[model samples]
Target chain A: MTDPSRLALVPFVSVADMMRLVHHIGLETVLTELAAEIEADFRRWESFDKTPRVASHSDVGVIELMPTSDGSFYGFKYVNGHPKNMKEGLQTVTAFGLLADVSTGYPVLLSEMTILTALRTAATSAMAAKHLAPKNATTLAIIGNGAQSEFQALAFKAVNGITEVRLYDIDRSATEKCARNLAGKGLTVVPCRSAEEAIEGAQIITTCTADKQYATILSDNMVGRGVHINAIGGDCPGKTELARAILDRSDIFVEYPPQTRVEGEIQQLDADHPVKELWQVITGAVPGRADADAITLFDGVGFAIEDFSALRYVHGRLRDSGHFLELDMIADPDEPRDLFGMLMRAG
Target chain B: MTDPSRLALVPFVSVADMMRLVHHIGLETVLTELAAEIEADFRRWESFDKTPRVASHSDVGVIELMPTSDGSFYGFKYVNGHPKNMKEGLQTVTAFGLLADVSTGYPVLLSEMTILTALRTAATSAMAAKHLAPKNATTLAIIGNGAQSEFQALAFKAVNGITEVRLYDIDRSATEKCARNLAGKGLTVVPCRSAEEAIEGAQIITTCTADKQYATILSDNMVGRGVHINAIGGDCPGKTELARAILDRSDIFVEYPPQTRVEGEIQQLDADHPVKELWQVITGAVPGRADADAITLFDGVGFAIEDFSALRYVHGRLRDSGHFLELDMIADPDEPRDLFGMLMRAG
Candidate 1:
């Protein structure tokens, strides 16, 4: 191999570049491509390295770093969740990620995942719903109507042919905001007064409430048979929304079994509760939705592979469109051994 | 908090910006400011959130993520050590780091620390040496003089006022490289045949060999009274240089006791072997060196806080010079509630 130091530094995709990519490719296309990449990566699940995230919890919130590498590529996401942030006029969850070459440990791209995260989360929901939800599903009831509600609504529209969305939030303004964001998206938006009203007769019930407690947004009787439940918000030890009765009645699916056991809707379920990993469903190694009457629950807690796929998707789009700036994040010493030369030259 | 959505997007500084900061401030000034920041951060040690680094080890190398936060700001370093990398014409160690806001979870700066790590490691050594070494120290012995030797020499110059450096390495070319790198720095660089020849009468001794196994570089008799030892290279399990007799005879100081007990030169010694944390010395809670006859050993296994301080210093310097590029690493929704709009509109 040629000297690694002699290789030209890789181009970095900054947040601005990522936004430009969205503008150039169109947001719908970005989500479409990102979803496709995630699906492809998930299908070849055995080809990557996986690990449970390392989390540091504080009284106000939790900070986590999710890392995974596919032997050749390494990706990690740094995210924070502070329920009180919204009260202080901050978003409840915020994140960013990095993509690097495993061989050299040099970052190849850094993209803004805050918006991308919403896109991916929604895409992931839609992706799971594709396999788990009944075909020809039309309406999605998004109970939370917060930052993630819009993405969830549109992703279902693009993937599952959903033409209608029922939005409900404790704060009416949040529900109004969701409707307004989805106004021109060619989907019918319904404003609901209560979570029950939103979930009533909906084919796909997405529970994304922000409460960091075990509050049942969907009870056992309210969730009917053949309805797909995309549980998005409850993702911590003390935080979960689905009642145990609801979980026991549904055929559950999870992103990673080890992680989902702790952070997904299954947190309320017993350890012995049989669940299928999403990858297994995608790979056809396990069955998804044994019968139409069997209610399917996609216990989505997000995963590192999704971020890796999102990063890879964004990197390709950003690089092709010339939307990024070159970050001198790596020191290019003429002689890698003479790192002191950089200092001497600086002096 | 103007609409919270408008402020959600965070700014990112790239590596190019960090190099500009170095160009604008000069390396010595940067190192001095960095050392001062490290000292300040150490003084307030209890206010920060600390965690032991997470490392992924491979047969030929090890990659680690060291993360920490001070309630408000978060930092993490991605570093790798492959002693064989140099032979493949790559630096034995390469690193990059990030600094972010804890409130918004936005990355503010990304910097190349492969070179800066050497500087910070040297700065950390000098800081410990200042507190532990005998007063008015001059001659210094640097065993295993490789890529890190020049920085060690200069940092000692900046902090300990050492005028002469004795260099010895198993690879003759590495010692020659060290000598070449320090030729005109005004310090007398003497190339020696062995560790014994290098430390015959030195007041300060620094060992930084790169072997992965336990190799005794220094025994009891070779180390004399009042000689402060900066043990830098033996930083992982199954990797240590100093014999047990040397540790038994010395007054050892460490960065963090829990971490040092696992990864430091003291790994060869008993678990309950008494040691002093560097922060305690900085806070004046613990004594450094009692007298001229006392032998003080700084088992430097590299700490997360030093990386935190270094990243903070780099962020401040780069921000001041306007060299940092704004990476749209943070997602900014015009209306925080309209995150879906940002993505949908892009599509």
Candidate 2:
């Protein structure tokens, strides 16, 4: 138990705790709720203060801090992307995040965002698909059956009523692993031999292959009209999934232009390329899925507010469940100015 | 005990653990070591990647993220300053930090930085005083005897061999509190009735008052020749301690001019006011303290590398001491790309 008098205790949700929380709430239910929370926050986009993530790049990988605030709460995620880590039995991406009271600037929650980031990223993609995908879209072609594959499959089904999923990865074992995981999830799961087979009869195609270069997972000829392409793999500079001609044919929508221009599939286009903002689309200020034949691409690079929403959702659920631990992260003195005295007395 | 797996488990220095670590090592020794560590990092300033801290300001206070890297290691501190917090029995400034291996992009340590930040700030001030203060200076007048007063008093003794301290605050109880804490510390401790009396014979006037606005704790006429003014409290924008005329009279040195111009005492000076970089002085690339009659001022705003050095020092100490807890912060799976599979199997 932590002392109540001191402000040292912060509630922390570990990865194990996160898995338990998801099961307790039902994974599909969690995804559906997260999508709703993200949509709600997006509607109030004007209220948020956003900035491009602050990154430190090295020869091997990059570490970034993504922060945002909405007058009452402040949140940030500490995430790293090291594509080569997977070779050493380490995750290519790992993350954690914190949410604090804007009034006090004291963290209320510390959470492992590795699992949560995949969840929220999928949630954001599903939320965008709900607005931009064809009205009766049911099949999802998930190209790249890696860490993010199953979540993307589940989230699309939960939020957008996706009933069929075709999977493809360069590694056959990856495709089989994703298929095995989705066996009893009430979806028509297909393990495709190639990318061409994955997109057959699929109105929604999500490409999430883990590559650190500008390799085209989907060329222009593969994409048909009126399909929603959720490109999730190409999220860093020099890393992209779609060819330039495919992006040219699709009506691009983005989370934040300044960020997407540098990181998303839109990086292939000119800086001045006209793309619709996702938040504006959510708020009904702009059109989505225009005229049913224009290929709408949610050039989703992900954003800070989506993570904020996910954290807020998880924090709200912690009280009903007991999967969190108290962390002694802050220093509170009997007399706030007697910091040295606190140390002296501790001695 | 924590489960040791392929996943990296960052050792966390909790507030209680930090207190124990300080007692185990002795606070004076910690201060002395921190000063040396800060000085060593300062000498290699050109090799460091420095940025003006990213700040998020609210009506109540400000929260900042300070990050620095030296090729092999990356470190960042999340800190908040809310003056109104003191009225509610909370420390005005609270902080936490993380250090990660740059090669792997994995956090190696997580620490409660409230105590460490105080230690580093004082060590930095004492480090600056070591070069800028008049040689053989013995007495220090600590204006605003609050949370930082005792540490400032001890750091000077540890780093620069100060033999006496005179304390003053608007609240006489604060002055009494500081003097009581310093009792029998092998130094002469004096509790003064006013700021003027506090600086009577002191050669170093350390102003560390906690005020949110531009209010002078030390006026122009109060300053004397050859005294090194360690102006600390004037850190954030609009909060200053020394009068403008005093800034003009003293030769000022700062950390990161881009940041100092916005947050330090030099904020009141001209946009291009000439000031010596502390790193240059420490590296012997620039001269420090022109002469005995010339007043030299260390306009310390604190820097990221100082916190990085403090964290590095603590990380080195953790291996030798048992005052740390392993945090299950990272999610590691046997299959690096099987995040969802791990969750599914956790059931």
Candidate 3:
């Protein structure tokens, strides 16, 4: 009967809009800025309320809700992981998220997180690497040339001054895809034929392959001393990429232990195994890369706080970018308690 | 960019769309249909994956995520309870929910739940009343005339056999507002000054006041034999409306025991107190309203399954109503692993 209230309109960033935003801001700048936002949130980790993602596991895949709040803003992501989906012309992981004002419980931004998750996951890895990688790391090896490979390459380049990227995947076409995408992106993109060749002369190694069950994309023999490993694919129970021997040799740093122990590559180890918490490292409570001679691993199973930070960052830029649609997502009656009156008036 | 894949566009029902759909199908029929949908889901309660909503409590309010799955479909509602928000010209509760194909982990429908929540809450209470209220009940008393008042009146009239409606509130203007809104809704609407006067000849009393702290809207002596008390507002800890003495006198039936113990009026009762689960009553596993003289109280602290059912109901009608908008909420690259290429192509 009347025009929808402005309070009811939530800003929604679609997948294409997210792409445009990244292009407008420059993906490298977005990555660098996202990493900074993530690092800031990590420094004040004590202020956040964390929980292991609530997952609904089915035979074919799993759908999960990752929610976190930092008093001022609240955010959550709906993500689904189905490794076999790629064969059906579907993504193995698809996501969307909402950022709401904690004070009023009204959604401020709703974004398609399938692209954003890739960006945040890469930024988080790059942030951890900045803390735990060897001094002046220059070259990176990406062992899985899948959906996340290019973003990881760019993030490392943007944040850590990496000059070269070496790529490898079980599927050669995937490696070509990654290599083709990285062409002319201001880095030496080397497409390697084997995982061993991919890691050759690289200081940082990132393994992100999609296989629902345990599969070693990186073995212990290949990982040398002083190299930082950003293991991303080993998220979700029973899905891991690094061999336990590789894990045993590396000084493991994790996002959230409770979640990492169940969903990260560290799920391969004993529950009580000693590992460094990355947030503590960022906050200076714990040492990162104590010595250059030891291998370090950042077991990054994506966390909700990263999504919160990503949403907060997007919400900040949405005002000027105009790359979003206003969604009629909330119910706002002229009188808060007159919802029925509003409904009756609709006729 | 190529046109968004059909799979990427999720149907979103806004508040206006929901009201239009409700009016399209008579409100009474929607209530009756929603009640049946809720009743059917309750009958097969074990089919759903259940968990108490994950809540983030702050100094001012609480934001929660209610998630559930019935094996085939997954649903979750992002709801915030901020009583202070109403004073700021915002709804005390504003919500939106998503229903996804659990098989693929992709969202199919997104609907504004603030209005839908009122519809479903009322339908759920009325459904329980149909099974637990005294036979030939006609008069209904609604205490705390707020956003939910008119829905309760109509739901009871549609689901159960109710004719006359009596309303009362601490603020008499709320009562007047509710009565005025129900003007031609096919019932005798009576606005009373006190809660006591409102329940004068009513067999069913619905108390739904919004208070962050415990306060008695209905005392012990006010409740008598053979009356069913639908306590809907004592949904969060410390926000109750009924006296402890009143809870002690009734056969308390609840949606879920663990949740009710923390959020329902039974929070005032012992942890080990024997209370009937509403699902059990609906499934005939437990008896409801054992006799006319036995007082029955439905401690309805809305649950995830009810939201799941409501989402399912809206999704079923979305195609025919054509009142929903399609938003590109998922990434659909031709090659699932070529997400980076999709972004580059968009540029």
Q: How does model 3 score by TM-score? A: 0.99
As for lDDT, the candidate ahead, 1 or 3, is: 3
Can you write out model 2's per-residue Cα lDDT over B148-265, one digit (the tens) per residue? 8999999999889999999999989889889999998878998999899999989999999888899889999999898999999988998899889999999999989999999999
Clash pairs, candidate 1, are A15-B328, A26-B346, A26-B347, A27-B346, A27-B347, A28-B347, A328-B15, A328-B16, A329-B15
The candidate with the higher TM-score, 2 or 3, is 3
Clashing pairs in 2: none
* Share of true Cα-Cα contacts across chains kept by each model: 0.48, 0.80, 0.91
lDDT of 1 by residue, B1-347 (tens): 12223354344444344555666886666666777888899899999888878776666677778999898888899887777776666667878888877765656776778777887898888888988899999999999887788889988887778999999998888799889889987898899999899997799999999877898989888998888999998998888989889999899999988888889998888899899998999899999999999999999999999999998887776546876544455556666666666655554
Q: Write the per-residue lDDT of candidate 1 for residues A79-118, one digit (tens) a residue.
A: 8887877776566787877787666565687666777788
In terms of TM-score, the best-performing candidate is: 3
Off by over 4 Å in 3: none
Give the higher-DockQ candidate: 1 or 3. Answer: 3
Which is the better candidate, 1 or 2, if ranked by TM-score?
A: 2
User: Residue A41, candidate 2: how far off, in angstroms?
Assistant: 0.7
TM-score result, candidate 2: 0.98
Q: Candidate 2 local accuracy as lDDT? A: 0.91
Cα lDDT, model 3, residue B30: 93
Ranking of all candidate structures by their lDDT, best first:
3, 2, 1
Superior candidate under lDDT, 2 versus 3: 3
